[model samples]
Target: MASLAGCLTGEEESENTLEVLHGWTGGDGAEAADALFSAFEEEHSDVDLNNKPIGGGGNENLDQTVSTRLNSGDPPSAFAGWPGSNLEQYDGVLGDIQSDVWEEAGLEDAHVEEAVEACQFDDGYSAVPIGSHRMNDLFYNVGVLEDAGVDPESLDDVDALIDALGTIESETDATPLAMSLEAWAILQTWTVVMLSTQGYDAYMSFIEGDGDESAVRDTFETLEELLSNYINDDAASVGFTEVNQDIMSGDAAFIHEGNWVAGAYINEDLEYGEEWDAIRYPGTEDMYGLHIDSFIYPGDNPSPEATATFLRFAGGETAQVAFNQYKGSIPTRSDVSTEEFNDYLTETIEDFEAASEKPPTLAHGLAVDQSTQSSLEDVLNNNFADPFDVDAATAGFMDAI
Candidate 1:
């Protein structure tokens, strides 16, 4: 309820001082970003807020922008980001958010704890949790499942889920799953499979390894098997836009996507539970589809008032409701309800709550550090898109990082 607008004075108040640069171009991404800015404007009417959305198709890479700005001594007051061990990159540059504020906001649950731990740097400060969008969820057409004699709710294990896939494929001419060539999404699908099979320990060990030859070998082998078995018809060729279109129509029965898919469904005027429902991707009995997304406040930030205002407004209950509702993500605050979501979303929430005790495995995109991200991104794009020498690709990825 505290307004950052109050911290400013006279001439500067109406100056439209804060320019937020983010990658929230059209679609639900744009709507969600706009909603967040609207909330800020409502609270601080005098502050001139300029929203400069960067990139399209989720191409806005905040890490690149943040690095450029911080090095140039012109960092934004606040910027969008996710927390992982790589948060250590900020070191002295990132600020320690007020713990009392996060706690009072009711964001100290186990999931929040996991996110904080992932985001925390050596100094113990972290990028504050804003909202979470569950990626790697298997969203499917409920009607299609019924037609295939597959029980949408009966997919309790990986075998059963795979079997259901086959049934759907045989019964309908549509693609059983709609996946994209986007490196992040492809890598996410791989991570979900890896995490589901090996669990969190193996994943952590491999990532933490100093390019262990054997570990890298096993990971690549697994990747090959996954691409060959589950995916259909040159999946490596489809781009993000094409994949979403496949899902939007009845061309595809399922798509491994993040919560943002809900926006596409809403855009199509389709109702959840009736037309579609999302289930935790198979092989993830221990882990639910939980991913943390947030904003990191630079430690050396000169505009304390603006940064404080941004963080406060972001975590506030009002902002949580507005942003999450529009973004089709779960509110970071536990006290908030998902009443706005339809039956399918409620079911997804139920699954997330049930698996709350299980530590959320970091989606691969945000799990590894920056240096490692580029390397892995290269591997994903290469292995998925082209017929590369697997052994060379594996070694190259490990070496590149």
Candidate 2:
């Protein structure tokens, strides 16, 4: 693997460095991101690659780091991020990589239908879709649920879910549901709760800025109930990475997260259906919440050639397959085979195909602009999570979108 030229010492000026920024800083995510980076490095041996990972709840930490760099006029050659309406924030600053990366990767014919409009920006593509994640997934510890006498299938709606939470609390000592009160995670949970309560049309309408106040209030009320009584007492102090692992440790029974968290369950030596498993987040069975992560190509990128090469690899079958194998996601390319994927991802792939509708996820920049996402994050972090202030949080959410 060659060294990228984006950030270099005096001796490395001759090499072309492509500093690639991403959020897969720890655990299985780091391994998955490494697979993609290693494959790209092997294919483009002449270019130096600098890997920058900002770790936290998904993009919670990464977005701010990228924003700080962008404000300081130091954007990476390419950064891993979401596509779709989220790209609207960087409209003018992004380059048209359609000809170099998109055409070279032959993405038009090979990628999934959802990948088409998602990568579009300024008459060309802004990023390359490597993997697709279903955001509305609730992973549970098989043993904990069995001990609590809770059936995942019987819990179909928010009310049933809360009842199960109570049953788990009363029957066992484990935290009923694991949670991270980080702004992004809270906001993510809030959105899914919104989806669970109101259905697909209303959920879509909410992110599009046409949401009903009653729905917003209702979502917050549920959030308050769950966070207040069902979770661990230390939820606010713990981060996502820690709480997610609680299921495997028998400290928690359930966690609401995307498919990415499943990789950790496997890494813990847990089987798909026996030790741990995932279920459709209550009420989201009819819909697939798309969490698309791509690599953003900035217009003023320093290592243009390296960036193109990296993007080309990112869009290829090799990179996607290797990454998603450990990333707990499916390749965006429809032609990519999933024989190597584990049991969980195989089922996720099937669910994606059979789902009635797939909407962009709001919590991770899929459903709204940067301003709205940031605003909601601030609102949730400042007013909602700790206090569980339903009315204020509802008002803040409505104003943000």
Clashes of each: 4, 9
After superposing candidate 1 on the true structure, give the runs of residues whose Cα lies further than 4 Å from its correct spot.
1-16, 57-60, 99-111, 122-126, 156-159, 210-226, 229-238, 299-302, 356-366, 388-390, 393-401
TM-score of 1: 0.82
Model 2, 359-401: lDDT tens digits are: 7888777788877888999999889878788878889888988
Which residue pairs does candidate 2 place in steric collision?
A: 2-48, 3-48, 3-49, 4-17, 4-48, 4-49, 5-16, 5-17, 6-17
What digit string (tens of lDDT, one per residue) describes model 1 on residues 125-173?
4466667777657788777777778886787755676677788878987
**In terms of TM-score, which candidate is strongest?**
2
Write down the lDDT of every candidate, Cα atoms only. Answer: 0.65, 0.85
Least accurate stretch of 10 residues (summed lDDT) in model 2? 6-15
RMSD of 1: 4.4
